[model samples]
Target: MSDAAILCRFEAARSIVRDAADLAMAMRPPPGGPSGKQKSAQDWLTEADGAVEALISERIGALFPEDGFQGEEEGRTRTGRLRWVVDPIDGTSNYARGRSRWCVSLGLMDGDQPVAGIIQAPALHETYTAVRGHGAFLNGRPIKASPVTDTRSAMVEMGWSNKVPDGIYAAKMAAILELGAMPRSGGSGALALADVACGRLDGYLEMVINLWDVAAALVLLEETGARFSPFLRDGGLDRGITLLATAPGIATDLAVALAVPLD
Candidate 1:
């Protein structure tokens, strides 16, 4: 597709994520009285997730009825060739607890590849945008991953999920420590990946993550010249995928430390 076409979709996604972020912030309930249910012992789902997703689906449908849809809250709607993937709130636990680590994530994918993405963290007052060939931006300012090349100097963020076994996370974390890099978990994958785009974090790695969580950030990583391993190598696009994103300079060592396949 033409660059203009990608930008057009990017603009639409940008608007939707911003609107969803605004609505989510306004509707957030007090921590003690939060309206949410446990999708699992460790997974959470809030009213904001469904509400924001419903609004995003409706709004995107209005503008692009021919496009497909897939959301963390709503599942799949294969209406057309291009699909708009969304995660209304990436860090539901943080959002449910009134923390500022949540974000609204949206991506436009043609087939299995992301072409455009937008991530809005309202509480943080930040918006990140990216297109396939165009560069990435943070609050409209161009951005890129950090230039840190050595594992000893790279400060990386690690993402965790209950879906994966405890031993897996332990192994990866130990490897990171052994490599002599600091590892931190920020509770939001999309936001963490956005930080990588803007050079705030040197790297991010997760064993298993859904498409919604990383869909938008993948585009940002690509446009900013950050490197990441292919997600869900063993499953279809609808299933969970392992994710690893790093500044180009630190990618090799980090990947090696984590035992991620470089091919």
Candidate 2:
């Protein structure tokens, strides 16, 4: 598809997500219906996640029915070389708890590389988008990663998967803390990456993440000159796992500190 047509498709997808996010924020949750995945001792899935995915999937299908789809809530629909990876409600846990850190992420990938991306947080009124070779933008203004040279002065974001063994999780956490940088944890990988793209945070580390979680923001980061490396070659929905993304200055240091093996 032409770049203009692709951008139009993304705008439509973004609108659907904005509506879903607004609806989710307005509705009150049922008392004691479900808690976080940690407390529940199971992966948490919510009605809002499904609702948003359905709306987004339908919109994308209407625009590009031949393109494949892989969404967080709904299953995959593989068909064409161009696939849309989506996270309808990226930070479901935070959204469920009324935190404003979540967002909707959609990425268009040709083969294994993302070519176009959009990340929108309706609650925050923030929208980030990037097309390969076109640079990244936040709310229509272009953004770049911070030029912080010293790791000690950096504000970093780190995330851990509940599925990781306790020992590994602890090791990763301890190692990150020892980096002597300010570390913060939020619920959404997409939002965290968006922050990195806009220079809100200097870096982000995650033990495990599905493609939908970082697909869109990955393009944004790249366009903004942020550095990232895949811990695994296969980052499809089925093989989601470790990833490290950071500002260009600190990418190597953070990767080495985390001991993320090189390909």
Candidate 3:
């Protein structure tokens, strides 16, 4: 499809998620309290997540039925050459707890490369989008990565799902602290990546993230001139160990400091 057509679909998809998020915010649990998916001790899901996923899937199916879909709440479906990766509600834990840091992430992938993306943080009134080769935008204005060069001057964002071992999370935090940059956590991979794209944060690191979580934001980061690499040399979709996305000139230095081996 043409870029304009993709943008139209993206906006429509974003609106669906935004409305879902709004409804989720006013939601109350039943007598038993909130329902959740115990994927494991650390990973989780909620009714809102599934609801948003259904909404996105329905919209995408209606608009682009030939495209495949891979979503956080729903699994994958095979179709044509195009695939849509979606995180209907990223940071579900935070959402379940009423934190305002969650978002909806969507990306259109042509084979393995992202061709279009959109991330909408409804509570924050922030929307990030990009079409491959068309540059990135936040609230309709173009964005670029921060020009921060020295680690000491940079403000970094990072995250680790609770699934990560406590020891490993602590060690990574310590390593980041040792780099002399201030660290912040937004609780959402997609949002943190959007921040990097808009120069709100200089860099971000995560121990592990699914393709659906990062696919859309990765395209925005690339279009905005941000850089990223896997935490290990072989850390691709297959390995899924770690990921580090950074802004402009800071990527190499941050990767070196973190000892993250690029693919």
Looking at model 2, report the run of 10 residues with the lowest lDDT sum. 33-42
Clash pairs of candidate 2?
none
Candidate 3 ranges with C-alpha deviation above 4 Å: 1-38, 230-239
Determine the backbone clash count of candidate 1. 1
TM-score for model 3? 0.88
Number of the top lDDT candidate:
1
Model 2, position 256: C-alpha lDDT score = 85
TM-score of 2: 0.89
Q: What is the C-alpha lDDT of each candidate?
A: 0.85, 0.77, 0.77
Error of 2 at 27 (Å): 3.9
Tens digits of per-residue lDDT for model 2 on 1-263?
Answer: 57786676666766766676676666525444444443344356667777777877777788788888888766686667788888877877767666677787888887777888888887788888888888999989999998887788888888766767879877876776787778888878899988998899988878778888888988888899887775326554467687777877877777788887433
Candidate 1 — which residues are off by over 4 angstroms? 31-35, 232-236
Q: Order the candidates by lDDT, highest first.
A: 1, 3, 2
Give each model a TM-score.
0.95, 0.89, 0.88
**Model 1 per-residue lDDT tens digits across residues 142-217:** 9998988888987888898987889988999998888888888989989988888888898888777889888888
